[model samples]
Target: MTKPLPPRNDRHKSSGGFSLIELMIAITLGLMIMTGLVTIFVKNSQARTEIERNNRQLESGRYAMNLLTEDLRMAGYFSSFNPDELVISVNAPPLGPNSAPVTPAMTARPDPCDTTVANLNNTYFFHVQGYDYPYTSAALPTCISDVRTGSDVLVIRRLATCVAGPTLEAGCDALPNGAPYFQASNCFQATELARNTGSRLDYLSHFVLNTDITLATLRTISCLTSFGAPAPAADYRRYLTHIYFVANNNVGSDGIPTLKRAELGAGGYTIVPLVEGIETIQFEYGIGNTANSAKIDAYTADPNTYNACASTACLLNWLHTYSVKVNLLARNVEQSPGWTDNKVYALGLKADGSANVFPASGTYGDRYKRHAYNAVVRLDNPSGRVTP
Candidate 1:
């Protein structure tokens, strides 16, 4: 009787959940899948980051090159006026004493044949000069604080393309107090400097123009005559000076190198950051044999050799320069993790096709990647007009 349990329902066995081994196996498979996905995601993210960094570097490099090239092309431009014939006469009867004539020949100084070239002012009539390895304090006292060591400096002087019309014209209204102003043939306006209280304007401030297609003279108007009549169309422009160099750092102590430009501004030269991650810059000049043939003959990296001159006759050698070889070393914005940059980078021409390594001294031992950009920029303005 005790065994008389309801007939054991063979079809309805006790139901239970998964076994311990099955649960463990499912968990293990899930964990493996999750780990693989995570790995894929991390790798993809890292790759994207690297790609973006490289793109940024390339874009910055291109921008730096374009800026330099554009400025170089416009160097020494003075409209249709001949810079060699420029003779600045600072004469002001009201100022009492007349300044001695300032000719291009007077601006020539004996070439010191050293890094001191960077300290020299813009003297050449066709104002274009460079300093090789101009980072030393003695060479660039004004810019040494920001300049990167072992880098070249380039200077360019020219006239602005735009022209201003007479101050009395419609669009060229004179400033307050009957101050003298300038106006180009196209009716552009340029106000006179109020701070330039001196009766005679500085020779550097005057803009020489080819007004009648036959004569070129400094455009000047007296304040008394500013409202009398419209001045003849002045086809000339304003003077411009630009200096370019590489800075050791850009923001704080981040040590991010940058390409900086110093441009003539209202308050004098103003420093501006052009491109970031430019570690070093080098320049080589190709001097043309103007005496024999107007063709480039030699390339030199030393400013002293390129500007070698004992007198005005020798100074003419600088005008023979036809082209500039620009070499820029650009670096990554951020440091790469667990990476080393130990390779020697060639900048330009070498004796045995070697040397010219970057970091010139000790190994960087840094995690930053670098690349070299080389470009040969032809100087159209200088090459076109050669001094006899």
Candidate 2:
């Protein structure tokens, strides 16, 4: 009696709807495909993030290097001083229309092994009461603290040195080429006070160190009475062999970060920020011929021409240095994750074996990246020669 099922349809002969097995299989395949896609997407995102980070670090490093190199190139270039080393002194005598009838004092000297040796006395050297906290307000884009004064400036000077110790020495007198100095300590110093005879810049001078020292507090010894005296008069009236460039770190009332510069006197500091994020600086001296470069491993307190006399000599003779090697360390103030390893970027490596490394070879001192750079900066900008 039961009704017989209709004859199977042609469609039914084919795959019909799906069997449970088929349905399960299809679902499994779709899930597997989705998992693979998601994994690819995640991996891609991570890779992109890492790539971006590396690129940023590389760019930051290059930018910092460019800034530092440019300033280093101009190390001792001054419009006033025809030859950079003939820097005006604390009591540097004014030159007549012609740089003649040289002051007997600057050229006075003791005999040297070489007859051609210039007089040490006649060499005019600049002195600084103390270096400015920030040599120039224009150097910085933004400032966090007020311009440091007096002891604070001296503290920075003391902290900055080739090596550490409390005693103020000739080495601590000024920050190497680009460091800072304080006020009270700077002006009150025996040399600064000694050199600061009259309001005129003749006696007062700014101090410059031959090497880079850490900036915290400065230790200073007046120019020697003679070349070898342990301590010289504050003014260096007794004797002064050479003057070094002093660089300063400071913030101005205008809220600009800057590096202070004082060229003994006539040439007051003109702030030029070699680079931003530069918390400190160090230097390695370079000397030798064009064929092969040589770095003076030992720190030389003075690089002025070794003229033995006390009075008149050509400042240019001492300015004969042709090359220099500059080392710079910059820090990012913004808190951010730093790189895991030292990176060598393809873009910045020069043809020479030398390569500029990024993130330095240490844990980030800050949460953000801190990069250090070392470059053999040619002092002569026009000609690629190493300057002393």
Candidate 3:
């Protein structure tokens, strides 16, 4: 009657939970998959970081190059006449009784050929000058910050291309006859006049009256007519002074080198940061022999060579400059861990035609990545007028 107890239920016993060994194998496989996924994620992150760093460096370098190229091409540009032939006529304030009719003091325009006129000590006229690497503030007064040791300084002087209409409100001020006021289409704003009171009258020589406007009605001095009948607003321009240099740091003590510009603004000279991560800058001038051929005859790093007094044979060489070769050393924003830069980069030829190399030691041995950029910007204003 016990009836074979219940034929043993073997099926239920076999279908119980998994064994310890099986659980261990499943866990091991899951851990292996997770390890692979983590490795891939880390590698992708590193790649993205590297790409971003490179792009940033490139963008900064390109911007700096473009800015300099535009300015260099326009160097020495006046509205429609050669600046060399122009002379600034400064009027002496009307004095006691009859002060000899105050024959306006006539001084030649800033000429690279004249040392006394082109000297920075004058400060009234715009002059183009440069200082090679390792120069001191004493040598370059416009360099306010501590510059990078081996970086060059470039000074550009020119007139702005923008023109103002002959409207009175556009900086034109009316004065009584013989009162001695600047007669130009555009007058400096109140702020500009206040900031540049010392040289305000001298800079007026940069402007000429509209040909249609009679010079007799404007109380203009003979200097205006010496150049030729003044042209209209379409031919007028404003003076511009720019100084370029590399600063030791960008923000605070971060050690991020930057390209800076000190421009003559409405409020006088203002220093502005243009591009960051530019560790160094160098420049070479291509002097052309206009008397013989229009092609470049020689290259020099010293702007003084173009100075009339610096080299008697090369006097007026600045006017013959056809091209400017620029070299910039660009660097990454962040340091690469465990990386060392051990290569010397050649920028260009020195003043004496010798190879100019960065880190003369043959190795920088730093964590930051660097690149050298070379560009030859033709000075259209100077070269186009060269006579073969």
Best by TM-score: 1
Q: Write the per-residue lDDT of candidate 2 for residues 1-388, one digit (tens) a residue.
A: 9999987668646556988999999999999999999999998997777666545555655765565455445543321222222233222443212233243343322221111112221222211111122245442212112333210111010112122223344544433332222211233344443443433232223332222233222223433335754442222111111112213353433322232322221112233333334433333333232322232332211222223312333232223333444444444434454444344322132112234333334543445455555666655521232333
Candidate 3 collision pairs: none
Candidate 2 displacement at residue 145 in angstroms: 4.4
What TM-score against the true fold does each predicted structure earn?
Answer: 0.71, 0.37, 0.70
Q: Model 3 — TM-score against the truth?
A: 0.70
Question: Cα RMSDs of all predictions?
Answer: 9.2, 18.3, 9.9
Instruction: For model 3, give the 10-residue run with minimal summed lDDT.
Output: 88-97
Q: What is the C-alpha lDDT of each candidate?
A: 0.59, 0.34, 0.60
Q: What does the lDDT read for residue 280 in candidate 1? A: 84
Give the clash count for each candidate.
5, 77, 0
Which 10 consecutive positions of candidate 1 have the poorest summed lDDT? 87-96
lDDT (10s digit) by residue, model 1, range 1-388: 4776677667967778999999999999999999999999999998898888888888888888888888877876665544333221121211114343322233343222212212222242435667676335676636335788778878776666554333233453222221112222222223332122332233233332222322322334432236765445454344466778888888767788999887653334567888999988777777775453448887777534454545433334455566878888888999777689887777885322235668777768888888888898887776666534
Indicate whether candidate 1 or candidate 2 has the larger lDDT. 1
Model 3 ranges off by over 4 Å = 1-15, 84-128, 167-235, 292-294, 305-315
On lDDT, who's better, 2 or 3?
A: 3
Off by over 4 Å in 2: 1-15, 79-91, 94-280, 285-324, 329-372, 381-388
